[model samples]
Target: AYLSPGVSEHQVLDASYLASLLENSTSSYDYEENESDLNSLPCPQDFSLNFDRAFLPALYSLLFLLGLLGNGAVAAVLLSQRAALSSTDTFLLHLAVADALLVLTLPLWAVDAAIQWIFGSSLCKVAGALFNINFYAGALLLACISFDRYLSIVHATQLYRRGLRAHVALTCIAVWGLCLLFALPDFIFLSASYDQRLNATHCQYNFPQVGRTALRVLQLVAGFLLPLLVMTYCYARILAVLLVSRGQRRFRAMRLVVVVVVAFAVCWTPYHLVVLVDILMDMGALARNCGRESHVDVAKSVTSGMGYMHCCLNPLLYAFVGVKFREQMWMLLMRLGGSDQRGLQRQASSSRRDSSWSETTEASYLGL
Candidate 1:
């Protein structure tokens, strides 16, 4: 059941306590009334089972396949071009790694969602932890990319060259560290258990009494609010610098950064907002009664689906949005076809011709 908005976190705690109380007392029998009511009603169990078997699993399977292919291609391209690595490329590499790791857990989830969490308790905990690691790492990497762009464009000569290698290594290390730290809750809390009513095993978080509130708060801060604030501030600084600067090429690059930041915000904002709202609702600030259960369910479903969709969107943004990336991809493709040497020669010739033309035009303009 979903919690109502505007509900105090304490209320959610109380509700959980109440649930436990009910489970231990006459309230458990009350659930039997609800179940009997549900069972007495005509429901298409066979059709539901069939849909789960045929449609849901197939859809998730397709998602897994696409995610693997897309992320794998990105990793290969980034690794192959390691000699030309920039701050952006460093972040992209981490992003690709995060996506690939996240996708690896999809098969487990697909099986759990379609049939059951056939995997044992250990697998469930590990998969759940990996999922969180991927999510947090991706978010942090995106934030890092935004800051890197801001530094590169606004501070340019000052911050771009000095300590770059060290900065890249540190940022990469910090991102992974934060990912593991935030994912620890998932590893600690996730479990697999058989549900008697559903006659299937489920894998989900099981927060301890002492740590539940702390976990929720940590999730709110680390998973959503902190990253959002970082991204927003970095992009704001980038915009301010762009507006104050005058170079056309720099302006164009700033525009691309803006696009990336905006896309990231748009894609992720709703999901986080939903999560925050759900947390609030769980606390008993929203709807207190059981009548609003459907609304909670809908919100949960939408947020969950949107969060998953964000995983697939990152590769497209990274690989397709920038001119440099496009050029790199084209070069990579040509090289894959064994024409890299010819392509390099063509590029060299074009560069020389452009340089000669620029010099001649300058001389003519000066009448020299």
Candidate 2:
């Protein structure tokens, strides 16, 4: 067993074997290191700050400014003619108010998305509550507008000849009340919480998982689906009424119905679909992986940004599209800063219209 320290055949074989074993062990270690490094790398669509720091702030800021101006103009035009407003105009006034409130909250959300929730929990709850309120109120107000138009068109002379003013006022109040009620969830559950992953404070929807899911479903159904159905049915009936009449104005009104419906669908559908997908993923129906989840997160942000634009679009699509609203805008501009010629022209036009036209103004203002 005691071998001499010399270069023998057995010693050569033993050294070569040991060298080969060491090489194999080192290769295995390197292979494991490579595997671990590969595993640590993130895939495409990983959640990151790139989306938050740039796109969200810019998008929200633009929306805020545009919404402010558009809604502000609508409110100003309506308020300037406050005493003369018809039931239709009254609903629009409330719609403008709701949009203003909704637009006001955008700066809060914008700042949060850009940096963090610098505003404390109280304001966070307030702002979030306003959003829900405005959302429900806006659509419900549109529904009100639809029904009002329906009543005015189909049974203007008979059904609403008495107590119409009082009835409309009550309906507006009721809409506000119901919107505030639905929005109570925000006040109750919209509290700020620290997200370590995002490494920032967030003022977000943080209800219990079950309640949150149910609430989201309710929002989609009541906030959008029901209103859409009501609007569609109302417009269909309105269209039927128009087909019986023959006027250039009615043709223009027919065009308006198509445009408004298309705009509503475009602005809202994608966002809700994205939200639904996110909910499904949360329920483990879709792939439960970071990449897919991050993609969904990005999509939600995008779609929500799109959704917020609907407030701005409302004035343009629903109100501004009306000839009367445009005329009002011109008159509003004249009141503020237009030339003497425009003012005289408006006055002359007003004088030229027959008294019978005055009775039709309310129905015309509703775009039907």
Highest lDDT, which number? 2
Per-residue alpha-carbon lDDT of candidate 2 for residues 213-288, written as tens digits (9 for 90 to 100): 6777878887889988888887788788877877686777678766767777788788789667766865768865
TM-score of each: 0.75, 0.79
Cα shift from native, residue 344, model 2 (Å): 6.9
Off by over 4 Å in 2: 1-49, 157-163, 337-368
For candidate 1, write residues 1-368 as lDDT tens digits: 11111122232334445445446555245555567443433222333344445544555566678778887777776776665455666677889889888877877776875777788889887888888788778888877776666565446532423246787888799889978887777677676765543466667655654465566566667766787788788778766765665656456545555666676667667766765666665576775333244344344444544566566777776665544444555666777788869766676455334321111121110111
Clashes in model 2: which pairs?
Answer: none
Candidate 2 — worst ten consecutive residues by lDDT sum?
A: 1-10
Lowest lDDT 10-mer window, candidate 1? 358-367
**Global lDDT of each model?**
0.60, 0.67
After superposition on all CA atoms, what RMSD does each candidate show versus the true structure?
Answer: 8.0, 15.8
